[model samples]
Target: MSTKPQFGADIETHHTRFDVDRYEDIYVVGDVHGSLDALKRLISRLELNNDDLVIFVGDLVRKGPDSPGVVDFVRADPCLVSVRGNNEQKILRGDKDPDWLREGDREYFESLPIAISFDTVLVVHGGVDPERSLEDHATDELLTMRSPHGDGYDGPFWYDDYDGPHRVFFGHTVHDRPVEREHAVGLDTGCVYGGELTAYDYRNDEFRTVASKTHQDRASSKVVDPA
Candidate 1:
């Protein structure tokens, strides 16, 4: 009898997971969306140390003024890591790389995993279907699914439906404020759209934000209630 295939078993298949346990503190940032200056200010406020790590919920590029700058900054710092957001996936799938992407930046972006796991916490760019295992989730689901039913930005979000063994932290569904739930937390506070760039302190169960300096797109913004 055939057994279930392992996710990320091959280099070609997606669903790669990273495990981080050495950090003294772990902070998961919302979608950067190329808001480099805002990200700089937020990092300054954090005053992170060598023992601390900062993880991005993805969408590090596109929508803001400095996609290349954000990519460079994150790549230069060893303390920073990210999951592959839909925007990043777009770059990977496109026939040509973005004109702004510097040499070697594409490879670094490609290296990003689909999910980052810290014991009971799971980080993804979008989110998983609560009822399915990580291995069962498609690449699109891990990178872009907001509602399990369809892409409609209506009631009954996936977070409301989630009853998790691992509390999920995601950033694709742009919100005016953070999406807070018992089993999932959404950190995409629409930083590229003149909203605050937010971060979640996993150890303290707290949130921190830095106000956006630019408004690139208003169409993606949403105001949703926490579960």
Candidate 2:
């Protein structure tokens, strides 16, 4: 494991690379959005073992109840890791601050990577910059980007244009279901909006989802103002 750091907008962008074995049961989860109960249920369904590793695509906080509980849960677990999401970046950039975050929780958020690479799969909160290589990708873009525009093509999502040697597993843009392209996958199924929290198991090439336990009215309001 090794990390490269880049600073943008007063936040540090940490990128990590991992060399994972083929047999390892690696799982990538979509945006959690502070749905701790849903997250727990989703994890339980995985039946994870000592060898299994789970990586969250981010937005672990904000827009649901028990943001602190989510942070604390992941923090205490060694097998879980996260990439920085737009929501996490927002808090870092001073857009909003919830009372749930503890001092250590803030540090944990700051330490999260902008991207995580394992084997041939790259995990990020948002889609990548098509114009730049992974190493040169901008930190802000990694956290907040939804789509990329280029060469008179005015209206297509980022995954539509992706031609990659590495399979990208990302979360950010909400879709009716998990969007799957040849080279990329969009896993943000709007878990905070009374939708399901999803997870992909790379080893088995499977997807698992747990339906939201939150009320739509309350969840919608929290999506706008997480504080």
Compared with the true structure, what per-residue lDDT tens digits does model 1 show for residues 71-158?
Answer: 8888888888888888888888884467787777767768888777666677889887867766667778878888888776785678
Task: Write the residue-wise lDDT of candidate 2 on 101-146 in tens digits.
Answer: 6787777788998878786788889877665666566777777666
lDDT minimum window of 10 residues, candidate 2: 218-227
Q: When superposed on Cα atoms, how far off is each prediction in RMSD?
A: 3.6, 5.8
- The TM-score leader among the candidates is 1
Q: What lDDT score is found at residue 12 in candidate 1?
A: 26
TM-score against truth, every candidate: 0.89, 0.85
lDDT of each: 0.81, 0.77
Error at 218, model 2, angstroms? 11
